[model samples]
Target: MSRREFTQAIDFRHGRVDMTHGGGGRAMAHLIEALFVKHFDNALLREQNDGAAFALPPGTGRMVMATDSHVVSPLFFPGGDIGCLSVHGTVNDVAMAGGQPLYLAAAFIIEEGFPLADLERIVVSMARAAREAGVPIVTGDTKVVEQGKGDGVFITTTGIGVAAPGIELSGDRARPGDAILLSGSLGDHGVAIMSARENLALDSDLVSDTAALHRLTAAMLECAPGLRCLRDPTRGGLASVLNEFADQSECGMHLREEAIPVKPQVAAACEILGLDPLYVANEGKLVAICPPEDAERLLACMRAHPQGRDAAIIGEVTADPNHFVQMSTRFGGVRMVDWLTGEQLPRIC
Candidate 1:
């Protein structure tokens, strides 16, 4: 088809997209060549393999690989969409293990009747995120389904990273007297998504804290190489994450209610939604544990960084072999910070 004909045949602004775009026909090829490739173009992606392959960096010790699928409703939500969320989510997952994210692979499942303009916007956002994070989208696949078979779009992302020599950290590493630190305020991402999806009343300032946490991780690791554990409080939130550590490490935990950070707006939104901020999801925050001796130094390092400016020493590992998480309430009462049993919200990234 001639350029004019192709341009005329495919609607860019107001076109109602169809399944043919994923049918491996001229339309499909045109979309890939014109949009996806244009922005994510790189030496690795240009080769187009089922997976990316490359030599490891010298001194690379442990290899870390993490995969996450993004099916957030509304496709676009406050502060971020599925595209940027996919990139940051996987990056944070890998970084939580004290790894430096090196590469990313993405796959898109798009609805047939979705808008081309929206798809282009999402892909561009993904490109920008990958570039800004210094992680390349080395390989990817795109599949289309009938209108009813899919949401607007779903993204599956896998990240590969490398850990430095001799560094060891795991859920089972938490021990009594170890200090627990939170990167920043909690529940911002989940509440933002909830408000956006329901069209609930909210201030424009309320937004999802979606960001890459690898740099902040590096800073913390540098200051506290004795860091025992690292985890981004994601799906199950802070309570679940701490419970997992306690169970695995065969240790109990004690948290200071006043030390755990939660933004006032997020706290208010969670109260209105009948949700506990402890059970709400967070995209840009993380939980880190280190030797008691390393706590102050690590907090200082975290505070010096922009992403972790609100870092706080919320708790400490306990001696109980039963592995319970307890908290010192703001009102001077001690309470159990148990595992989260119910879903706080669904389709929340």
Candidate 2:
């Protein structure tokens, strides 16, 4: 069937997705045209092909790809939903590689009986995020599962990017005497999720710090092209990311508790929940490891960016056969920041 066969438009306000929408029939086409394509309209997507194809400009440099799936509970949270989170997650992954994101591919797994209004809202949010980040969603797929078998919706986004020329970044590139820097406060996203899930009201307004960081990484590369490594402390938070750096580079890390920046409200919330802020998740933050000589300059540059305004030099790399991440406490004691033993938060993107 063609446009003419779609006699009536989808009742987005009152309609719920059913099996026929995923049956590769008229209903599927109608849904795609009325929902996904309508919001994600772009030159590449207009072709309506199985996959999007486009030409890369000259001197595009090395290509990088990263994919992530979002299944955070309570799809709609205080500051963000799974839609924008999906875009930011994969885009940040590509940025950590010193790459400039170009395009994105999204795939949705929606359950039967899910509200069309909510699905449309998600798609619209995703489109807005892609537009703001200067990346386009050029292709995608959709699948429907039985109501009880699936969550409300799951989003998987794949991002494609091009690395900056003459700059190579990797997890194992950190060396002894390098400096570690954090973008902003820790545990905002995780805390926001918990607050919404448990319906707790706090004195201060807390929201998820979910935003794109490609521009911030680009600025860091411009300021200190010799930066060794960059990593986003997402699910496992700052401690986990530092440990990963130590294990990969076979080095130790010495951190100052006072230098780490944690919002007072977040700190209080963590204390109340019997959780350590270091192990909490962050959506819009990054950890950068650079040579000791360039640390100050890079820190200055990062502090000037919106995404990194609260940036701080939290630690320094050291030579230790044991590869431990130790932190100096405000009370004049030292402790080991080891790998998280088990899952602190589940279904947290």
Candidate 3:
């Protein structure tokens, strides 16, 4: 049904979602057309088909696909909300494989009493994020749940991308002597969420580092085509990503304590909360492994980008049969950067 056929518009100012909105009737069609279709308007989505269809450009190499679900508490947080976070999370996943994200599909689960105004805000944010990333939300689904059974809202985003020929990246590609690079400071996203959740008043303003990194990955691949691996540290933080790389490649990572970057505010927060920045989550930061010879070029390329102004060569890969991740403390002693044993923060992503 066309939106023009509806006699009245959705009450964005003072209306709540109910079971009828998701009942697959005229109410559902009107809700979708008035809100989602209006915000995420595009040729593909306008078709109103069960699925999206399009042709890929000739010479486009292997197709890459990734999906992520956002169940963050509070729904809204500093720097970003679940809407944009959902888009960035999946885009980065595809980017980590050295691919250019082409399109996205989103699925929303909203509670019965969710405010329409809040839902519109999230949908608009998602549309803006997709536009900035040069990707489109070509298709989606929406469902309503009982008020108490569902959280305010949950979003799951899936992305499809294309990797150019001869560009390959994987966790198992790291080799001994490769240089390890980090995009920026850690724990900003996690700390920001914690502060907002606990209502902690900190001296400095902190925000989540949620951003799409496909552009950064493209630049890095152009500058250093020999990159061995790329991975974003999310729920388990930098520590978990390094441990995964080590185990996958059967190598050890030796990191310098002083080389790792951490904002002072985040560091202070971690200390006060009995958390380690290394174990805290980050949304916009990424870890890249490249040959020692290509390290300087890759760092230069990354540092030139706005998203990677704080890029640094924090460590190097080593041959270790045990596949461990170790760090040299600024105190002149070595310590094991083991895998995170327990959940430091839950619903972090």
lDDT ranking from best candidate downward: 3, 2, 1
Candidate 1 lDDT tens digits, 1-349: 2242355445667775688777877887677667777788888877656677799999999999999999998788889999999999999999998899999999888888888889888999999999999999888878899989998999999999999987788999998999999999999999888888756766546899999999999888888888999999998899999999999999999999999888999888877878889989999999999999999999999999999999999999999977999999999999998988867678889
Write model 2 residue lDDT over 1-349, tens digit each, in one string. 2343688899999999988888878888888888888888888887778899988767988999999999999899889999999999999999999999999999999999999999999999999999999999999988889889799999999999998678899889999999999999999998888887756565458999999999999999999999999999999899999999899999999999999999988899898888899999999999999999999999999999999999999999999899999999988999999899899988777
Cα deviation at 301, candidate 3, in Å, is 0.3
What's the TM-score of every candidate structure?
Answer: 0.95, 0.97, 0.98
Best by lDDT: 3
Candidate 3, superposed: residue stretches over 4 Å from native:
1-4, 199-203
Per-residue lDDT over 245-285 for candidate 3, one digit per residue giving the tens place of the 0 to 100 score:
99999999999999999999899999998999999989898
Q: Find the candidate with the highest TM-score and give its number.
A: 3
Q: What TM-score number comes out for model 3?
A: 0.98
Assess the local accuracy of residue 80 in candidate 2 as a C-alpha lDDT between 0 and 100.
Answer: 92
lDDT by candidate, in order shown: 0.89, 0.92, 0.93
Error of 2 at 73 (Å): 0.8
